[model samples]
Target: MPPMVVLSFLDAPVVTGPARGLIHLARALPPEVRLHVAILRGRGAGPVPPLDEMSDGALTVHEIQERGPYDPSILARAVAIAWRTGARVVQSHSYKPHLIAMAVRAARRVPWVGHHHGWTAENDKVKRYHRIDAWSLPRADRVVAVAQSARDIVVHEGVRPDRVVVIPNAVDARDLSTPMTREEARAKLGIPEGEFVAAVVGRLSHEKGQDLALRALAQARAQGAQVTFALAGDGPDRAMLEALSRELDLGLAVRFLGHQKLVGVVYKACDMLVMPSRSEAMPNALLEAMTLGLPVVATRVGGVPEVADDGEMAWIVEPESVESLARAVVDCVARPEERARRVAQARSRAAERHDPARRAERYLDLYSALGVR
Candidate 1:
């Protein structure tokens, strides 16, 4: 028999979070299962690295040149790729790709499996496309949420609970947990040694609360905390964050490193991982950081609670409050022994929960349980 095929569509190049999770799952599957991804666009409108180019072993990636951001043509092209690849299971990652998969499935009568990555539909641009999600979601054969919080939203929004599978995020930690020293990682990136480095990883956006982190950093510095902040990943909020950094006179104290290829290196070089997201599903960066044994300080919103308990892993602060967040950072920095113990616990938990091989087997079960709708 031919291998069961999975067709994936992602919005970005770096392939973090659900994208990275899916790739990890795909790579862990048996040889009889074939996986191919069709992305709308990649890093920097940059070249879409071939499927084989980025694979660790045998996973294949097929890239498509997107016309523009959220371009309709990309969705249309995805359908063509699905047919060309002889895919048995159509898996769509991003929201646009979900719509595209449903469209293709509707025409071809194929099972459209959606992996929900929780794109913000409240945006003005996405609000214009409200009808699209409302229309496609009900028709899906199966939908997987990266976080239970995401599943709750889909279920509350009227999607069938049975149809939505709550598969929380998982990771291939062994690959990410490189045995590189912090000094070497810092040297590779030219960061000064001995400075207290606080790293926040995510696209710099309002929802991500990168700006909120900067505000908290500013607050802590004003209170006589000697620290430098580095932000990884870039997005629509780049100019705004850069301006905010300067406005706060965070010169040289905060640096935007842009999108990184080795997030493991970023995690290792940091003293702690801070996520001040106003809204999120379970962020993969948070999981990765925990797996790498770094203490975390994140807002208590979305699936963050699912990743870290209030006093476990790292500090969890109330959302949208700079004062509370600053206190949380100070608390973590002051209690180094407690923080180190928490990091050890977090790494242990991450190893057990997100074991790539185990999660991939669950995905296989999901596939077997899903039939044509």
Candidate 2:
């Protein structure tokens, strides 16, 4: 039997949600099922995926460094790589990979699985890609939606509901199960011992709503909440977000930590995780925070509500409401006993619902049903 080929098209190998999920999936795959990963347009900064490390010697990686997004040569190379490797099933992430997989499937008659990680479509480029995905997904043999929200979009866009499956992103529950204590984690990160720290981990982008979090933090501090905020990850909106922070007079109140590779330490160090994303699709930050037993205050958007429980695992707030966001953070900060209780319940839920091992088994089952031997 040929190996399963997973295609991820992104600028780099960062610790984003989709990348992390792929890493976990590769780690948990059975030895009999060899895995090959192809990164279209090559790697970027940040920690590379541990595919080779995790899959032992069963994983083969192929990278095609295209000069730009519209590079025509990548398509040919990707198709050749899949056909040469005898890919039984080509699972694709994002629009570019979907097109590549489509071409490969057309040539080889092999099945293609489209993986949806949700979309922003905020700009023209993303909008065009979303349009492409909308058209391409229905043609895929199977579509793996990372959340119910994504699956709904897939079904709404004309794909058969039976052909689309929802497989929520997985977190390594074992890593979070025995992480460092909050105090120890804070000490390691050089955070003050008594500060009420809130972590917002995601690309610093408008859609991610990091600006909203800054505003909320500013409001909470103005009301004498005695809190500090940390913005993790980098993006084009960093300058704008920094400017907003300055405008809000959040000089020392906010710290911009640029894409920390050790994201686990960031989760552990924070007193609570705040995800004020105006849009989301099963945010790995929220899931990881929940799994690490960190109290979360997240906006009720997209797949967040699907993945987190309101008032049980997380404090769900309205999207883009600075007041509501601030109030939730302040409330979470004030209630330690409640936080601990929620953490216990959230940990149990995360282990049951989002464990990497279970996620891998589900993918393997999906593969079997898809005729991958």
Candidate 3:
């Protein structure tokens, strides 16, 4: 049998960011490195069905009960699972998975790492999440940050700087992106060909700050620059943003298209992508839009500056300043040539920065260094 490796994440198969990253990494690994994934808890018993049938030697996934930090019983269960699967190394992502691995390390005796994937200190809920994160990171042999910005958090919270690995989120943008015709794509997406299009391509929530983006676009449209805004993705704040839209009199101009699975289509469909997130770890949506050659107008928070160079690739605005964002949007929409240049620059740069093959090779180096079985 190949050298077995155990991987643990919050979601067993399908999840938004961290889980998807874990899945793709397994596929990219050499086949000789056998893999298993464990999930701490789910809505009910067993692995989620569709993915359960799909997992095998290359990926073995499971779910189990867990309580507070470093729950010994749960960690023991994980160690047993790894042992039976012949796994010689264990890796974990997110909070509970990391703690359990840490708790049971004596028994498992396997080299392990924690892949921290969120902005833990920027807001309230995440700070609570980071308390757990802070507790667990030191116990691991390696600590991986999805962005340099993410690494800053742990280091500020006082994790040794040397232990942190800043490997960013990676995607195959070359396969995912295609150059688009603005007139044709606008017609396909049901927007009039000449109308200025601005979009916010994430959940309508506090952290994402979609409301600010919408207000900015509304202000731009009010200036007699024909404009339309699309709020793509569904979340708890959908109704709130809708109410704010009506109160702000941004009817028809701002359309809410909920939870679009084909987000790549969103990139091609919009003339510009706007992300005014108050905080982010490393935004996949923004990266997606850039890869598809859409000019991005986003807030300079979190890992955004790492990807977008203001005026070179995309416009970077301060968070919560509706007027500043409005000014940037108006400037771009007024000049067609400038928009095209910005789009081209953004597309090429996004591909260069976040290539999955390059990220996978980095993980390969980390795994090899740890002597992953």
Candidate 4:
């Protein structure tokens, strides 16, 4: 196959789940596969490190400044990059890039692959943006959904069933191969050694359900569970969630660590990971925690059940149910042997099913089917 160009948006200081997955996929691809990344960066955005620094110079990176959502110059610049690189296949992540890829395909006749990382309709503005995504997805040559449930949603939105594919996110165990011990990690984070730590790692937003996790934590503590909750990652909902935490009188029992750059350290310091998302599509945190042998108590939504079965690998609960979530946490903390058994199975499952190299091979197969040689 000729060189492939991946179009994405990355303006945050900390690497997001989709961006991290892209890096892992690029690194795991065979040495023969040439990948170029075209990043559409907003003005005054945070510093984006060179892709070559992360990929060991294996990827060619292009940064295009985006003026607004409907900037016509952005399309011209993107098409120019495709023509310059001779990209045979153009894969795009997120909504805006999907639109750009469609335009690029029209101008250059290149195959477009739209990657659907589930939508976050946190506000009216975002809901309107997602409608645009729904309108653009069916036009792509192929649509890649991170989970089966995500595929179902897009299909309902109008994408052809045969055109959509389910590819769960991948995790590299080697990234946390030599994690710090629990004692050392707790010391670094200033967490109490005697408390059982359950971490919720994601953006602080309504869709992420950090507030639900806070409510569950309060309920669990009321039931006499000695667990401390650690909330990681930063977003628009941080202030609201912090105020709710104080309202619950969760003093000294909850810690808000904003946008952890070294997330593996947070995983090491915690005894378990809680994914209380009201909505998700193959969360990278779940896979990372599984790879690290940390037991998980995740709400049964999106692609979570596809990754970890309830009572088999990780404890699964109903979404938007504080009582169910609290019960799961309390039960998980009460049963030490059960946590050990589940995490053992979870680690093995993560390594076998979610390996980045394996997922990259699947993408290659898809590329071949698209007449890229």
Instruction: Write one digit per residue (lDDT tens) for candidate 2, span 1-373.
Output: 4445544443346445665666677777876666677865443433446556644544666767766647878878877887677777787888878888888888878888888888895689889888998999999999999889889988998889999988988887544443578787777767877777899998888889998999899888877788899888999999999999899999878888888777877877787899999888888888888877789999989999888788988899999899999999888888899999988988888889888789988888888898876
Give the per-residue Cα lDDT of candidate 3 at 300.
88
TM-score per model over all chains: 0.90, 0.91, 0.86, 0.95
Error of 4 at 35 (Å): 1.3
Task: Name the lDDT value of residue 114 in candidate 4.
Answer: 90
lDDT of 4 by residue, 1-373 (tens): 4445544433333466777777777888776677777887776776565665666666777888878756789989988988888888888887778788888899989788998889877899989878988999999999989999999999999999999988889997655554578899888888987889999999899999999999999999999999989998999999999999999999888999988877888998899999999999999999999998899999999999999989999999999999999999999999999999999999989989999988998888888888875
Clashes of 2: 1
Candidate 4's displacement at residue 359, Å, is 0.2
Once fitted onto the true fold, the runs of candidate 4 whose alpha carbons sit more than 4 angstroms away are: 1-14, 177-179
Off by over 4 Å in 1: 13-16, 41-44, 64-80, 129-131, 174-180
RMSD of 1: 2.8
Which 10 residues in a row give candidate 4 its minimum summed lDDT?
Answer: 5-14
Candidate 1 backbone clash number: 1
lDDT of each: 0.78, 0.80, 0.73, 0.86
Collision pairs in model 1: 51-61
Backbone clashes, each candidate: 1, 1, 2, 0
Off by over 4 Å in 3: 1-6, 12-14, 44-58, 65-73, 120-126, 174-194
What would the per-residue lDDT of candidate 3 be over residues 186-304, giving only the tens digit for each residue?
55566666556777887667889988877887788888667788888887889999999999998889878787655666666777888888888888877777776778888988888
